[model samples]
Every structure is written in structure tokens, then in C-alpha cells.
Target: MTETTPLNDIIASRIARQGRITFADFMAACLYEPGLGYYTSPGRKVGAEGDFYTSITVHASYGRVVAREIAQMWRNMGSPAGFTLVECGAGNGRLACDIMDFLAEREPVMHQSLRLVLVEQEPSLESAQREMLAVHIDSLSWLSPDEFASGSFTFSGCLYSNELIDALPTHRVVMTSDGLKEVYVTCTNGEYAEEAGEPSTPELEAYLKRVAVELHPGQQAEVNLNAPKWLASAARALQRGFILTIDYGYTAHELYTPLRKLGTLLCYYRHQTEENPYLRLGLQDITSHVDFTTLMEYGEELGLQNAWFGEQYRFLMSAGIIEELEDLERSDVSDEEKLRLRLTLKKLIVPQGGMGDTFRVLIQSKRVTAPRLLCQRRIGG
Candidate 1:
């Protein structure tokens, strides 16, 4: 290809030697291959200047809403003397800062007991996380993905991730007339291309069966083996507490419906959706929709109760966004600034072609007795 970067060349050379590489491997390299990958590069990945905006980039209100839930979680755990809050995929720690700020201000007791462990793959981001979390440094620590997944880092508190699972490399497969075949990356005319072949593992088929989804002929889908592995590790590491996950996704049936022939994998660059992941190499961010059903099912298997799973808007509204809005009215800022904040916050929960409906929140708990949460509030409450 004309735009062959270092990572691209590395990936190309590997594929040339191996004949073909699973989309997962290609994607893993594209997004996380040391210095050359997308997330490993030195540039902004979120907010107005970056590729795309997650709910955290919208406003501090989102994390504040989450902090409200975390406070409830602390109460649910009977005001534990010690609690660990591990945030995976904690990019730059902005959300963590917001949560820490809210806890210090509104839930001093919990804040005092809180131990926030920021687990991120990119070691370089720790500086940014440290800078952003300067106020809560004593309550914070860092953990590499390998260290977190090592099965020795057990804790009793909440582990959360926002839009993390969707970034894990996934195996792409299609139901063909012959059978299920994986879509592997190959070189064609000096450019990356796809080639269908037999799946590398039986788990691909088992994953579909576990979800009870049978793709239509020629329909391609992604199987995130990493998701279950991640969940299993999280379940093991969490001796007792909750796993809160927020991402854009669907239930198994909804995600693997017959209509989606090309699967949900997508690339983002400069706020635009790019269908071609082959073009940008490490420049574009690659992601897919999470499957909440699998998370629920697997959580149950791992002894974690499916506490709550629903659209982000419902979770936000039921949790505490309205109260946040009410607090805005009492702030010293002018009404014009308040209005701007309101509009920006609306993006966090606005449905119908917005972040609200597409993104989902899932909260699963382990060894928590009959517990009540703020999101359990009735619609009118």
C-alpha cells in the first residue's frame, strides 16, 4: 500500500510469512502494537481534537452519575472499611478524576476507604492519568493488563470499564454455504485483503452456540473470545463486589441478527466512520459492539449476579442525571453556561441516533446481599 507505516509493514511482513493472519491479530497489532499502534502513539484519542468521543468526553456529569452509583455500591457493601475500585481501559484518567472528585466532595467516608487502581495497557498514559488524578494520588495506583489478569490481584470492590471490551481484538467468521469460515487477513496486490477459510478454533462455533445465534448464510460476525477471558479474569480478581461495564452494544440476538452480514467492526478517524480498516494502519481506532448477553451469562457462570443491564439513558436517568441538572441551577455560573452544560450532558443520554440508545450499562455483583441501587429507582422517581 502507498501508506505503509512501520506497524503496517510489520503486520504485512508477518502475514507474508504466515500466509494469513486472523483479523484479531491484525487488529491487535493495528491498535496496540507497541509504539506504532493507534493507542500507543502520541496523540489525543478522545474529545474535540481526537478521533471520537466516549461518554466521558461529553462532560463531567457522566462520571459524576457513575460516582453516585459507586457511592451506592459502597453502601451496598455495608460501608466497607476498605474498597478497591479498579478501572480498566482508563484512558488519561479523566473519568477517574471526576469520580474521585465527586466521592471526595459528597461521599467522604467512601472516598477515604476507596482505592482506585487504574489498569491500562499503554504504560505511557500513566503520566497523563497521574497528572489528571493529582488530587487523588494517594487513593490511586497503576496496574498493567498482565498484572491485573495474573489472577493474584484479588480485591473486594467494584471493577469498571467503559468501552473496553469492544476494543479487544475479535475473530471474524461468516456462515457460508460450505460452513462457518473465518475472515483472515492476507496480502493481495501489496495491500491487505480478506480471505475466508476454516476457523482456527472450535470455540468460534461454540461461541455462537452459547449465544444461541445461527447466522444467516453469508452473514459475517465477530466472536470476541477475549471478552469471556477478560470477564473470567475479572470474576477471579473480584473476591466480592461489582463489575460495571459501559459500552455501545446489544444483546446476543440483537447483535447477531441475520441482517448484519458484514458484522459490527468499524474504524474511527477524525470523527468520521471509516469502513476500511486497512487504510489507516495505526492511525484509526478500531472497535466493535459488545454483547451484553454473553457478559450476563458468563457472569452468572462465574458466580457474579447480573444486577442491572440496560440502555445508558435509562441507567443515567434512573441513577442521578436529573439531580445533577438540579444542582446546576444552584451553581454560580451564568444561565448561558448552564444551558451549554445541559446540552452537552444531553448527548450522554439522548436516544435515537445518539449515544443514549446505542450504549449500554451492565452492573454485576458477587457476594453482595439483597442490595438496592439508585438505578433501581422507579421511572417517575
Candidate 2:
């Protein structure tokens, strides 16, 4: 018996007009509607006090490690004079700031030729991104999601995102004796409910077929067709360079197993996980775990090489976490601060149940061959 929110009313009206909408459309309205959706609305969505915590919230060290890897990507491309780094879902620009700071200090040559394109769906976030990345304003630009994925915004250095894909609207489907049926949203006594019907797009079935996934009977799952479509757009946009995506997900095989029959759709509100997505409408953050296998497979088909994919800890360790720790130890900070820094960093690499293993990193490249990325190095290196 939750009260109807403005977003809820809007969605209900849409459903009333259209006679029920697909879950994906409902999610899009809930999370990205003009002024009241989860992301489009004005409220904190990340970090300790927000709905959920992303890797950027853990520490600056996380982004520094990613910067170290980006430097390697530049080196892999043979030190291009005009390199561009496009970061989609650039929230508050914290990660970009950390990367820019590290690049300006350590890889000055690369920084001199670098241009960063921040692509965010919410245009209002530009002000916050601008404020956070004020020091690197000379090298920054902004692009809307439509503009970034329009197959016109070309870049050359690298494109990256952290926890971006899971937030994209995804259609839900359930396996039945008859066949795969999509889960659509319908009004039941003025409350949102689910109904099984034919999929809105044939791509949902084809996505599973392409990934060689066959869900067990009665297995309910989410299909993020937008992911591959987005990747295709990313591929088309990147004339050359690499695509780095960091998020929490699994391969198609692991993701479609019978153990997880209910799929990975999750909601976050006030730092707690909520099972029902219908409660607060735009208030809670709804997300589905990404499917990395489709990314790797579809990337290959789109003329991108699957460079690397693994746990976050491995990426951080092999890339530059140890070096970051060493630098902190040699810094002017006090011993107590160093200890706190060490513990904070541990949160990024602590194995099992921690962020380290739960999250993952996937790197794909276009036109770069035999690239020697920092993530391929030994711990000390």
C-alpha cells in the first residue's frame, strides 16, 4: 500500500493510455523520465549516504589504477598525438578527475594531447561534473547519451565506464513450457504488476540464441538488449582505441544457470537492498547485472578485440594498486592516515563477498594489436 509518487502517476497514465507497457519502458520512465526518474531527479545516488556505493566511492586509488591502465592503452596505441578519452555515465566526474590528476602529474605528454568527452544522460549533471573536474576544464567536453551513441562522435584514445551498463533499462523474460515470454508491466488494482506476453522485440530471443543461453522452465530473467546495442554504438563511435567497462556481472553461462532462476534484478534504497521494484517508483535505483559474455562475443562481431576480462582485484593489483600504496607510504601524510588509506584500498581488492570479486572489468580494443596493458603485468611491475 505505497503512496503514488509523481513518477508513479506518470507511469500509470502511460500504461492507462497504452494498455500496459513493457518492463523496459517502465524502467526507462522510472529511471530516466524527464524530471522525476531515479537518475534524472535531483538527489544523491552514489556513495555512503546515497542509494548505493560505486567503486568511485571507495577511494581515489581505484580511479588512479584505472588511469594507470589508460596510460598503457595510450602506449599501446603507439602514443598517438591526438588521443581522446570518452567516459560515459560520468557521475560527478570524480573518476575522471582522479584520472586527469594522475595523467597530468605522471603522464604529462599523454595528458597534453588528451581530450575527455563526458557522456551523461542527465544534462543537469554537467554542472557538478564541471565543478569536480574544474582543474581539467581545458581538456573536457560533454555529450548526451544520444549524441555519444549516434555513430557520429568519434574518438581515438579510450572509452570507459564504471557500473554503467547495469543501470540501462532491461526487458524481463520468463521461460515457459510454450516458449520465452516477456514480462510486461500492467496495472492490477491500481498497483503495478507483471504479466507474461510476447516479447516486444525479437532481439530478446536472438540475444539468448546468440549467447547460447537456454533458460530452464519458469526461470525469470532480465534481457539487456540495450547493452549490445550500446556496445555497437560504442564500436561505431570509436574509430580507434579501447573500450573499458567495469561492473558487477557474469558470463552468459554463469548468469543463466538454474541456481539463479530469479535473475539478478535488484533495487537499492537508502543503502539497503529492496526486493520489490514497485514500491517507490523513481525513488529506488533498479539495476540488472550485466552479461559480459555478450559483450565479449558481440564485441568480436563488431570488429573489436576482447582484450581482457577479469575480477576487479586482479585488474587493480596487476595495473597499479601496489604502486599506489607505495606512493602513499612515501607521501607526507601521517602514519595513521597511511593506515586508513591502506584499509580504504583494501575495500577495493578484498576477495570474496567484497567489492573485489563482486565487481569485474572488461576491456575491448579496436585497431590496437599486441597491446601490452598494465593489467597484464606482475604485481610489483
lDDT of 2 by residue, 221-307 (tens): 989999999999999999898999999999999888989999999999999999888889999999999999999999999999988
lDDT of 2 at 303: 98
Per-residue error at 201 for model 2, in Å?
1.5
lDDT of the candidates, in the order given: 0.92, 0.92
Please identify model 2 stretches exceeding 4 Å from their true place.
none
User: Candidate 2, 129: how far from true, in Å?
Assistant: 0.7
RMSD of each: 0.9, 0.9
lDDT, candidate 1, 1-381, per-residue tens = 638788878888898887899999999999999998999989999989999999999999999999999999989998998899999999999999999999999999888878999999899999999999998999989999999999989999899999999999999998999999999999865688899999999999999999899999989999999999999999999998899999999999999998888889999999999988898799999999998999999889999999999999999999999999989988999999999999988998899979999999999999998769898897549
TM-scores for all candidates: the values are 0.99, 0.98
Question: In model 1, how many backbone clashes occur?
Answer: 0
